[model samples]
Target: MALFPPKNPVPTPTPVPMPAVTKPSTLPPEDINRAKQLGTCIRARFAQTLVGQDNLRESLITTLVAGGHILIESVPGLAKTTAAQTLATSVSGSFKRVQCTPDLMPSDLVGTQVFDFATQKFSTQIGPIHANFVLLDEINRSNAKTQSAMLEAMAEGATTIGGQCIALPKPFMVIATQNPIEEEGTFNLPEAQMDRFMMKAVMTYPTAQEEQRMLTMLTHLGSDTFDSRTLTGDVVSISDVEFLRAAARRVHVSDAIMKYAVDITATSRGAGTKPVQGLSTLVRLGASPRASIALTRIGQANALMQGRDYVIPEDVKAFTHEVLRHRILLTFEALADGVTSDQVVDSIVQAVPVP
Candidate 1:
């Protein structure tokens, strides 16, 4: 009794379980080194399969690394479809070509519900949009309804059928091709849908020498060419491709650069330039927040593709147009005056100070 008990017993607090600390990948030394090696191999392989268009090819590669969609506008027979197919082959991804026409329907691109007489219930028949790489050939040729069908998958990466949303395959990308020369039967993509694409690239005709070389290559290769050689026999597994994209989310971007991207985009809206040019004056709409995001990722991807561990201003500059062009919308007045979106973007880039 004299000894009694300890003055008072204290209650101990339960330990809070912290998230598993992930060790930062020091594998940059190894991973990036291998990525660069694969990139080199890809470049060499593409050079053989395709001629010229170095800029476009690099942009396409950057798009893949950036995990974004691309819209290619060009005349027919310029290998637009071939370029998309070759790209898919290089990545060893499933490819599907959608011949968009006026008669094309939403179900045509995203599948539809079918009545299974035996089962006495409706079943979902998936469409070509389920693949890893989809070539929306002549997208502009499709009617507004048909074009709208792609909006969901392009933006959400999934299609809803029979009240259930089906996720697209990993590394999914839609490389849409539109013929800008022919507007007679073509339906221009509404501004809303255009912005869904990360970049709108124009595929121009090859030069005389390049064309002649392409012709020679075609004539000389008599059934010797396989569909397309696999770049690494599996350099990037589907899962690995998903992982690489997840890693991109961790790509560091300083606030300074983020502001730079915003400023450049905001300036396109109403911020004035030398003559006080405002996109509102000429543009019906300005680039959205998604545009900024695309720029950041694409910029980081551009840096990574060049074997750099970090992103820089040059990367942003290189990707600015592609990221912003399609997102910016010019008014009818601007169109009547022949003021193109490219010109507007150029002005904004010049006006916005580089960081």
Candidate 2:
């Protein structure tokens, strides 16, 4: 023991708990089984009825299980309305079809007040918006006021009558169709109104084989009532849809991915650098923060549809076209130069790197 003030003891270093790096959950076997079964059921039904449209079928399943609205854009007779109506029938939910026109009114879609002679008071009458599933055919044919009425219901999940609010049914989702060819009699969907839709899908012409199949089916079903065909009620339900929504909210999105979304949107607006995709030059408006949130939510649902418990870069990439295309607005110059919303979305997806 050579003294040096007894060699002052170094205080034991207190161990600080390192922040936990949470691991993303792997796909649960049970969820995978259920999702696959649901996918199979949807395919079996859609395959017999619709020819070609692999993309449409997949997107429809994703949208349905994800609890989001869909917008189908196409020329008339492209099966846009038929596809929507088929899905509504398969879901076994209350389905209402509203043929949008210039004369359509707000009260027409969301109901109005009626006088009750017996009770000597006004009673609230519900509208087609109260259904679990809606087919808004040729939505662009409506005037601005009528469009606004539909938009308000889609955004708020409720309708107002006589200053009173009535909540819509559970699992409420709209499948709207627009004829892109006729612009003269139609009102363009407002940018804000377009953003309310979770997905914007274009319905293109089917292949030769698909067309043959469609023609054959139509010929066989002639003079028969199509209304008799019904879907199984137990396979899916409004309550089940609510549960899927809850599960979607729980899907984990990494911070790296979040930053990627922010950077992409920022780049579009020329926030700190030269614009990408000629976005600053062509776009009068960029997507709002709501677009980011919608993307993440739909991405999660897309993942779950694929039997994954966590979202991957692929999920985000697959859905960007549908989620962002309608949100971005192009200037007149951009339209003249053949720049469309889909082109801008494609540019953003290419510019943003995945984690």
Candidate 3:
């Protein structure tokens, strides 16, 4: 299936462009340069381990800088797990991979109170969710109950263990992967849980050149398994991640830009005083306020990566599909007509006025 509809399916509306703002970014020049260096370092490290999927790499970095969780959907053998693992290992922190299954219990992800016979006392044993980077491979393979257990950690960065709330490590992020091809024995993620993610990235197959490079790399290694830890010398420290996030937060966001984001989200929902045309019928539900916030923050991250202190319309437009795809729910008619969330988002972007 096509990820998006044909170009210009919806009549292109003349964008009512707003006057450009002359304000500069709040971040200092040194900080902006540092952010760019960090972003480059991460991409370079990812290139050493993973073959291609530039969009996936950028999405991961943007989400990391924005301090948000991500949901990755793709078929098997697309290196979804490899990408997540490479991102985790590129940073100097604890990394954990949870292979989700139907029988996986909540305690398997969080933690449980264990009774120790040797000490005649109960001790708290934390689970894999406490790590800095957590890769939940095949997340949908687990039952809803087990999936919901991650809510607390993802939202609040803390989990309640035996009536005690334990804070997770800082610089924490969840990169969840789910196979779209296999639906049997897999439970769908709840809407509430879905909304918790800042962005949902969809990975696609690589090009012929990229695949050939993969084959060459595999032949050079003489094995199928690729160890991402080979680039330990170039690992980005936790402090660097914190600094990059701080810099991203400092990236300037104007009121007009904020309004543009809200407008795009509102148009998708077909809500407010003036909803954009041609979207109400296709959308069962629009993106939430969180999506608006995500759109703005992701723009900030993108701007920082580009060595700019201020966000532009292009930054927000660059990630609109990723930010709003999983958030919007489609109607029966839209689905029957083979409409995707990407198409809906594309139409909204074209219809909304740019600031």
Candidate 4:
């Protein structure tokens, strides 16, 4: 890693504001019969209700099927929160939402021990993280201490409280949102924690047509309360999603694609000759091996979503931006030079040869 890499130092511009639930999880069927159908239904429902954010819908669905945490960076009113809740409803899973505040505590998320008055025994009280789907809204607004509590569940499916680690629910997934363009009263996520996320998705503005559709949907739903709970119609049985996840683990990737994925990670490293022509100077650090692994798993999920049993390079490239964008740290020099991680990823994908 370089002691210094040219990167963006621009003061994060204060940007637009964003506008933004829990239920018992029915055990999904044990069979993997409807996983593919579930994935398609989730996407379709989002398209209908979300009105826009096509890119977010695609990347988020990929991460969900892959079973990984995602960090979404966008201004408010972009439906990041709504999307998380809606996805949870699509699967009929238990959902929990935590509003990240500066005063939030670790125990508030991971849980603590409470003394039972009758027995004088300290029983464990689980926190919001025990649910199958969790939405950590405005994650950066919380202090590091509060943020630390999420690391375990997000990374290991367990959280430590009262000196004990409690396992979270099966198929746990967290969709954490941060305001990347704001600096007020927000704590930067520790690098170690950042690596735990499978992807950092940037939500872009909706198209004019999409925005118009959103308005129309809002008009149609007037007084109807288009809440996330409404997403629970028969999409796929819970069992089907479970089976699909198991199937995704078996999705085939050729060795050539594997090597190509590794090469991309290695080339992103700032230590050696830069793999992408102009990036060496801009990046202080390259994508981690975890990034490589995530890329592969996400590729499999992509293939699975597309009803393919095997992965292709295009599938790998499909998620490169979201999977590696935050993993690659840009140098102050790169920022000064107006270089973006998206550009670096593009350069690497274009320059890397397919096998």
Clashes of each: 0, 0, 0, 18
> Relative to the unseen true structure, what is the Cα RMSD of model 4?
14.0
Candidate 1 C-alpha lDDT tens digits along 141-197: 888877777998998889999889999998899898888845678877888798888
Candidate 3 C-alpha lDDT tens digits along 1-355: 7998677677778999999867654888888888888888888888777888989999999999999999999988998988898889889899999999989999999989999999999899999999999999999899887887898789888999899999999999999999874466777788888899998999888999999999997887677775874564477899999998888888899998999999988888886435667777799889999999999999999999999999999999999999999999999998889999998888788788886
lDDT of 4 by residue, 170-287 (tens): 8888989988745578778888889989989898888898888888888877733447645534655556567667778777788888888888888788432346666668888888
What are the per-residue Cα lDDT tens digits for candidate 2 across 1-355? 5565576789999999999988666556776667666667666777656778877777777787777898988877787877787777766568999999899999999999999999999999999889999999999998899888898899999888999989999889999999884566877888778988888888788889888888887787673234426433334555656766766766777887676666666655655233474467888888888767767777788877777787787887787777777778889999899888888877777777677
Candidate achieving the largest lDDT:
3
- Which residue pairs does candidate 1 place in steric collision? none
- Regions more than 4 Å wrong, model 4: 1-33, 223-226, 270-274
Candidates 2 and 3, the one with greater TM-score: 3
lDDT of each: 0.78, 0.78, 0.89, 0.80
How are the candidates ranked when ordered by lDDT, highest leading?
3, 4, 1, 2
How close is every model to the real structure, measured as TM-score? 0.86, 0.86, 0.91, 0.87
Every model: Cα RMSD to truth:
8.7, 8.5, 12.3, 14.0
Cα error of candidate 1 at position 15, Å: 26
For residue 99, model 2's alpha carbon misses the true position, in angstroms, by: 0.9
Q: Which candidate gets the maximum TM-score versus the true structure?
A: 3
Clashing pairs in 2: none
Runs off by more than 4 Å, candidate 1: 1-27, 223-226, 229-236, 272-280
